[model samples]
Target: MDLIQRFLFEDLDVRGALVQLGPVWRQIQRNRDYPPAVRSLLGEMAAVTAIIAGNLKTPGRITFQLSGHGAVSLLVIDCSETLNLRGFAKSEGPIVGNSISELLGDGRLLLSLDVEGMQQPYQSYVPLEGETIAAVFEHYLQQSEQAPAALFLAADGDNAAGLFLQKLPAADEKDADGWRRVHGLAQTVTPGELLSLDASVLLQRLFHEETLRVFEPKPVRHDYPPDREKISATLRALGREEIESLLADHGEVVVSDDLSNHEYRFSADEARALFDTPPPNLH
Candidate 1:
């Protein structure tokens, strides 16, 4: 089953998270036919997105976006506090690279956290600086959260998984070298182990000697339902003239949301009806 497992070190001020995705990862890629390298990149983002969203203390959503001027132009992944995920990757042409720097050439990574009851989402940006997705996120967490973090992410056509470790404030007070030791142990994890092993068994294999408390696993899934009304409202915003022009040229208005793998096609009559009805009230 696809799930995220959280754990704490009994004698240390450090916590960890393990996320494994099977069905949900495949569902996200159901609509798009990405190149092998691009598919792996998107899968890694999906895994890390789940891990980060699972750690949110409040109800909200988190988004990670990578924008670049390369073969892979954009990569977006959104995950809610409940672990609902949806995302897609946009590319200019055939992708040839396997590393983040190669795929994203001179790009920036943007993180947005929309917390409950907040007027504006919290946002941050950092230049792409790592060879892998895991390294990039590790740098971001260390810089933005001011917590030393180590992340291991891996994915293939079938599954995506990640292991995250963050050293809380004053972690050294509990055990001076605890964070370092844990980080070292975590680096030993192989991509095969991540995709194949069970969370509890994997934790034991990595940190068997440590005093740890493993929590119950929380489920994760792909949950992006088409919002027809919202899509209609968007068409309305484009104005009637634009909609009619599109209909005259193409016979229908088609709006594709690559991220959610949803398509909205409006017949000429349906497109015209949008303006005949009242727009949704903002308040």
Candidate 2:
């Protein structure tokens, strides 16, 4: 199981989020054989999503999207307020890079928030400006949120993990020294350390001198859309002639593109069953 833990600095006006993902990450990677670089990047981004979305106050979802003219064309990860997550990547050729810039040449990263009651969702975009995913996230927080923040992220193809720290707006001159000390101490954390240690051990090791208030952790799960709704939507999108031709000639209808990671195959009877089911929730 995967879990995210929230914590607060008792008197320094700082907050943090720590995430450790194991099964959830493996499940996502199991669906596709991502390249070494792509797999690492995706895992990092997924952990980042859990850290950010876990802090959301509204009932909604956050999506991280990256696109560029490089070996990898598109990558997207969606995390709901409840901590349900799903993600995938699309590439045109071999993806080779140890960092965001090398992998996504001239790429842009977009963060979109879809709040349930808002008339329209809010979005922000930034040029991929850093050597690592953690640096990119740190830049975004400083630029868009006008807050002093730091991110520590790591992944090993099998599991992913991350830690986020932010100085709250309420911090004053008295807390300035503490802020510096905290950041300085956090710098010692390595990618290997983040991926291997439990949240309690990692946080205590990093902030043993600071007064901290830790909250209970919550579980994060992998959620897939209902098969009935997904199947019906694909069947309805096809013209009658096309559907008939697929059934008569191919014996099954394929719903996804050739470049997609997975294909949805359905027989004529299975397609009909999809239509008989109730419609999925519009919201």
Query: In terms of TM-score, which candidate is strongest?
Result: 1
- Candidate 1 minimal-lDDT segment of 10 residues: 92-101
Candidates' TM-scores? Answer: 0.93, 0.87
Global CA lDDT computed for model 1: 0.90
Question: Each prediction's Cα RMSD?
Answer: 2.0, 3.3
Could you give candidate 2's per-residue lDDT for residues 57-174 as a string of tens digits?
6668899888878787778888888998888877767667677767778888998999988888899898887887888878887897789999988887878999899998876554
lDDT of each: 0.90, 0.82
User: What's model 2's overall lDDT?
Assistant: 0.82
User: Of the candidates shown, which would achieve the greatest lDDT relative to the real structure?
Assistant: 1
Error of 2 at 269 (Å): 6.7
Residues 155-216, candidate 1: write the lDDT tens digits.
89899999999999878999999999998999999999999999999999999999999998
